[model samples]
Target: MATRCCIAGGGPAGLVLGYLLARSGVPVVVLEKHDDFLRDFRGDTIHPSTLQVLEDVGLLDRFLRLPHQEIGELTADVFGEVVVMADFRHLPAPRPFLVLVPQWDFLDFIADEARKFPHFELRMGARVTRVLEEDGRVAGVEVSQRGDTQEIRAGLVVAADGRHTTVRTSAGLPTTDYGAPIDVLWFHLPRTPEDPSRTGGTMRPGSMLVTLNRDTYWQCAYVIPKGSLEALRARGLPAFRRSVAEISGFLGDVVDRIASWDDVKLLSVQVSRMPRWWRDGLLCIGDAAHAMSPIGGVGINLAIQDAVAAANLLAAPLREGRLLPAHLEAVQRRREWPTRVTQRMQIALQDALLSPLLARTDVPAGVPLPVRLLQRLPLLRRLPARAIGMGVRPERVRLPPAG
Candidate 1:
């Protein structure tokens, strides 16, 4: 198979890029290893900026029609006192809130939309195993579907395969760790009508539990130090449930539902980025290029931003058959600054707050000074809300639908 762009890993990055380029009348193929898009990806926060991207692409209305919970304000339980931290109500955005939808649903929506474009093809169960290269530049990929392995040649091969991206590794692109000191234990707790109406975090003396309102349940995350999953599991299931219940006692009744350790999933959080996102015919985007910490649930949004940016910058060149290595480098140059700034913020949040806070076993005090201020001064809350809801240098749709 051959095309203008062959994308590996049909996650947010690949799907969005494929849709944009194909909509612009460029031949594009996205290879997704899984036959289905059903999986529990922890980060599901879609910010208002991403909604704007959808609006630009004529998808926001239809997307909003889907079932999703809106988080207009983020409230954190600090020292057992619940305080509103960031409020999106006043943000200058198309939608002034975060949408909590399963990642699979969001991906499927885009996939369905992309299928309408004549030049776009999404191959589920096609796992890219190798990067095809010519003269030291990426030319395409080797994708295995069912029992057949096929060579796909393209003008460009995008490695959106994710943090453990095979294409980037096969291409031997070097990455630098920005340092991460935590991981998360994810599980779910049944929700009742009596529980709080909004989604937020529970900060304990030495532990942190973040929850997303999944409508009928709370998708919970318990943050702990890096490489501590084994020790946590060794503590025994009963003990682990007790610890989770103790930390997030609000879900006391549902704690028993976590019956065994198998109910919990561990995500080894990573905060790092490739020094450069592209080389020759290959360009890495999303988690493949920059893995984000689950700090503010911003990773997915950042990945979507990268897709929009890449599409905006590369669609015309890809369509015109004038693609160059410089075009790939331009994507890195455009996105690197925002990636750096976001990672710095995550690192600072971890070191100054989470790391020290998670190491404790007793209650500290009221909310953090900054959060307390946001609670007291409701108007001032828009600052952090703007930061989280809009992000840095949000991208707009540049390619109109192919007519």
Candidate 2:
């Protein structure tokens, strides 16, 4: 099989880029190893900037019709004090709030939209084993599907295949691991009407939990020191349930819903990025280019932005068959700054806040200084709102949809 562009991984980046490219008349195929997008505990925060991209594509109304929760303000409970972190109500975008929806629904929505264009194709259960290289440049990919291996050649091969990317590694791109001091154990507990209406984080003396209000149930992340999963498991599931309940008392008996360790999924947090994100005929974006710390819940939104930028810059060239190595470099140039800035902030937060908090045994006293400041100067809250909602450098839909 051959196409103008072949994207590996049908996550936010690949699917969005495929949709935009195909919508602009470029033949694109997205290879997803998974048969479906129903994975649990993925990043589900769609910030204002991503909503603007959806609006630009004229799918905002349709997307909002899907089941989702809008968060206009971000509040966190630090040491039992609820502090307002960000106010997204004032962001300069089509939607000034964070949209929380299961990532599968989001991916499926984009996949469904992309399927409307004849130039687009999504291959499920297709794993990209390696990049097909010709004369030191990526020609396409070697895909493994149902005991069959096939080569799909393309003018451009995109590696959007999450943090553990085979394409980037096969292409021999050097990546710098900034490293993270934490990992997250994720699980869900039933929610009741008495629960907090807004999504927020709960941080106590030696524990931190982030809860996303998913209407019926709360999607929770229990943060732990990196490489401590075995220690946690040895501590036993009952002990783990108590720790979560100790952090968020409102859950009451629902914490007991975590029947066993199998109900919990461990996310080994990583923060890393490549200095250069592309080669001659290959480009890397999203988690493949940079694995973000789950600090601000910005990974998915950032990946979508990368997709928008990639589509805007490469669609026309790929369609016209004038694609150049420099065109790939342009995508890195456009996205690298935001990636650097966001990663830097996440690293600082991890090192200064989370690492210490996770290691400490004493109870945290008083509202955190930054939280106090945001509360004192109500207008100051908008700064973080803008940073998280709009991001460092947000992309818009520039390539018009193909008629």
Candidate 3:
């Protein structure tokens, strides 16, 4: 009998895993609760690192053809001084910059690709309610949609669900929370004539803006402490706009344009890590395994990386025989360190930026002078690209392949 792999949550992570496994001729099924891939304000920035992965999987051309914007530079303004963190010009790829594309469109493209494989099956509107365990090992999943429920028996079960993962929770997996002090108030404002330079869109000072297609509207982000959204809203639209204006340094009449509460939406920020990403016959990837705060624009990329890593390691064993506990353990060992390091780095950066006291006065011991000196070097400016592209190696972890 062939090994059956059941993947929960058909987001980028699950879909990509299914695509790779299906292409390799492994039987796979993806269960997604949503009937369609249309979610608002998801992580849309495709980082340079993720672009390389897409290229590796032969989806680069398709991804680039989508309606998107090329992000050239990551600029930060502290007080009145400006700092450019990463310059895409120095990166060695044909397309060196991040691409700002809607998450729904990207997922749709991946799903379409997955459809080409006969072994890949995507069941929309299917929500996994419980993980089926037999003799303390994952056997399959119990899922429901509308009014119907069914048990899916599989050799392997993959949970790609978001932060509040039902599988992870049901399995009683341990989790570590790296608390994020700040949250994002995401909103869109009309592109005004006064800020022509920014009509191209820029991460100005303390705020972030992505100019969505010909600069009709800007996807703007403002930082606030976690759990402060209701308080901010209670103060009303004028106060909300004023808060945004103050944080962003009163960007050229753009603040005045946000007239109503409906214009802004608030999202909480969190970074979480599972103690162990896998157990007997079960594995978790993407946000289910590790969730990073949306600070460095790495969450989506990391999720894709997780999917790729899982597919590369498990597909062969899954194709030949029964899925083993050792295989899942190997996957966990390979993935844990990179996820931990990345999440830590994100938290550190978040602390430095979101906290006013830290941003202004609490410079780390060796950072100030070197940071200043490095800013002068053109080569050093592209460190962010290097960090994303080649900094972490997943192969460092040793794991045995199934015989």
Q: Which candidate is the best by TM-score?
A: 2
Write one digit per residue (lDDT tens) for candidate 2, span 131-225.
99899899999999988999999999999999999999999999999999999999999999888787989888778999999999999999999
Q: Candidate 3 overall Cα lDDT vs. reference?
A: 0.73
Prediction 3 TM-score vs. true: 0.87
Which parts of model 3 are misplaced by more than 4 Å?
1-3, 92-94, 192-214, 246-262, 357-371, 389-391, 394-403
The 10 consecutive residues of candidate 3 with the worst lDDT sum are 394-403
Candidate 2 segments exceeding 4 Å error:
none
User: Candidate 1: deviation at residue 94, Å?
Assistant: 1.2
Q: Which stretches of candidate 1 lie over 4 Å from their true place?
A: none
Q: What is the lDDT of candidate 2?
A: 0.93
* Ten contiguous residues with the weakest lDDT in model 1: 360-369
Model 3: per-residue lDDT, tens digit, 33-109? 98888977787877776677667667799888889878677665444345666677667665688788888988898
Instruction: Kindly give the stretch of ten consecutive residues in candidate 2 with the minimal lDDT sum.
Output: 362-371
Candidate 2 residue 396 C-alpha distance from true site, Å: 0.6
In each prediction, how many residue pairs overlap at the backbone (N, C-alpha, C within less than 3 A)? 0, 0, 0
Residue pairs in clash, model 1: none
Collision count of model 2 = 0
